[model samples]
Target: MSTKYKKLILSLILDAIGLIPIPFFDVVWAPASAYIMTKMYKSKEGKIAGILSFVEEIIPFSDIVPTFTIMWVYSYIINKEKVDTIVEA
Candidate 1:
């Protein structure tokens, strides 16, 4: 994949990681996710990844997994690339 798309994917993964629940809400999660996804939207696909990250923030901690799943689907639809890997860092 091109470096830009790689970066976008990396950013999306970062958003996903941030969305993962903890004892306290990660306040930085949604905004960071939104910023990266907005950048991706502006760069390539028109769909917004940040919005899904926002949804995770709006919901309770337990709901993050479901939100992540939805976002993954959205990513697939928009990117059309079967990237088997997901980032941990």
Candidate 2:
């Protein structure tokens, strides 16, 4: 598969692992997701996604959404043009 798909799958797995009900898992995951998101996309959207993913994991009950994977899809696929517009601003 392509590198992008690999990164997406990795982010999804990390997000799922972040959901485990173990102590400090979210703590580790939140920052990790942030870093991964930043690495995957070097743009404003990536920065926002990193922060958003971190927040989503840090807040209890907010982890229901896989922010990292969702952001990946949004930035790279679903709304690629939108991110470019934001970056140009």
Candidate 3:
């Protein structure tokens, strides 16, 4: 499979793992997720998304946001159009 699809799958798995309702789990998972997000995406956008993921995971009841999946879509789909347009210009 391509790296993009691999990233998508990984993001889904990470989002799923984040949804677990274990009490105080965010204390450990939040920072780890932030680091993973930065590593997975890589760039200014990745850094921003990592911060958002950390905040989302840290906040109570906000882990359902699916930050990784959203970032994947933003990076690969939404942002791709802009890059393509720039290249075409």
Candidate 4:
């Protein structure tokens, strides 16, 4: 698969694994995944640092939505671009 797809899948898997289920995983996964995504995302594509900062600002619970949305956006963008390229080619 493409590097973008790999990155998306890896991030999702890591985020899922990082979750602790009951006690508190939001505490750990928020920062961990945010940092991972911030550093890993294509700099030209999205506001990675800004997203990370937003997540950081809210702490654990706050990150829950943005991170997932960003990942989805990443995957969507990549796939959409691929489809467009294929159609043009």
Q: Which has the higher TM-score value, candidate number 2 or candidate number 4?
A: 2
lDDT of 4 by residue, 14-84 (tens): 55554445556556555656565555544533346435644653465443344544555654664566332
lDDT (tens digit, per residue) of candidate 2 on 19-40 = 8888778888788878877777
Which lDDT tens digits does candidate 1 get at residues 1-89? 86445655665566458656565555666565566555544432323445765665655653445444444455555445633333312
Error of 2 at 85 (Å): 12
Runs off by more than 4 Å, candidate 2:
81-89
- Candidate 4 stretches with Cα past 4 Å from truth are 42-69, 75-89
- List TM-scores for all candidates, in order: 0.47, 0.78, 0.89, 0.49
TM-score for candidate 3, please give it.
0.89
RMSD of 2: 4.1
The candidate, 2 or 3, that scores higher on lDDT is: 3
In model 3, where is the ten-residue run with the lowest total lDDT?
80-89
Best by TM-score: 3
Q: Each candidate: what lDDT?
A: 0.52, 0.76, 0.85, 0.51
Better of 1 and 2 by TM-score: 2
Candidate 4 collision pairs: none
TM-score of 1: 0.47
What pairs collide in candidate 3? none
lDDT of 3 by residue, 1-89 (tens): 97778888999999999998889999999999999998876677788999999999999999889999998898778888543322110
